[model samples]
Target: MSTSTMNPETADRSRRALAAEQAASLAATNDWAHVDKDRVHRDWHELYGEIAAAITAGAQPRDEAVQELVDRHYAIASRFYAPSRDAYLGMALLYAEDDAMRDWHNSYHPDMVEFLGAAMMRYAETRL
Candidate 1:
């Protein structure tokens, strides 16, 4: 409760989280138009957790369950990124090569990003 007892790192993280939530709301209100930022983020978070679990369980990129999760992932992604082969392919490559994106994905699990990248490319190849 007191500043002396509070962990600075935990307090900083809480502050950053609140700031991010406010920023998301402001973006949606100012320019996002019809997009529901909260809903999209919540759904994406759920899907990412599930996808990470599947990958940790040793589900291959082309596994039936993994494919289904990847499809759901793409649908969510398409809400922000226009649904198309190029967009999906770009996202796949981004996940694979972008340092910031890789760090975010790796925060979920060590291999989650690579697994999602593979599934993204596979989905693009087969569905797009």
Candidate 2:
């Protein structure tokens, strides 16, 4: 990992490329692609990014706002992943297991990986 911080412009550009690549990878393997990657990334960064900031500021996984964020997380992920609860949980786990995913979250906030996992589990237990 590089020890440099990404400026907003650079980060946005990098995120777009990464999103497009991941969409292509998913499509190549699964026979479908999410064409609205910019929208997806925009929402993910704006909404989920806010949640990560809240977590960093000491929000608990059980918080109502946090749970709502988890709901939004599941919804957005369904565009790129699967819509089932099982797939949602699997993705929650993958955030921790995948180096790129985990690193990307950590890049924005240090507590993000575990915080998001806990929030997703809580959401699954309470909602799904």
Supply candidate 2's per-residue lDDT for 12.
47
Instruction: Tell me the spans in candidate 2 whose CA falls farther than 4 Å from its real position.
Output: 1-30
User: Compared with the true structure, what per-residue lDDT tens digits does model 2 show for residues 59-100?
Assistant: 998889898888888788667654444445556555776799
> How many clashing residue pairs appear in each of the predictions shown?
0, 0
Best by lDDT: 2
Error of 2 at 113 (Å): 0.6
lDDT of 1 by residue, 51-123 (tens): 8788778898877788888888878765654445654555655565668988887888798777777776567
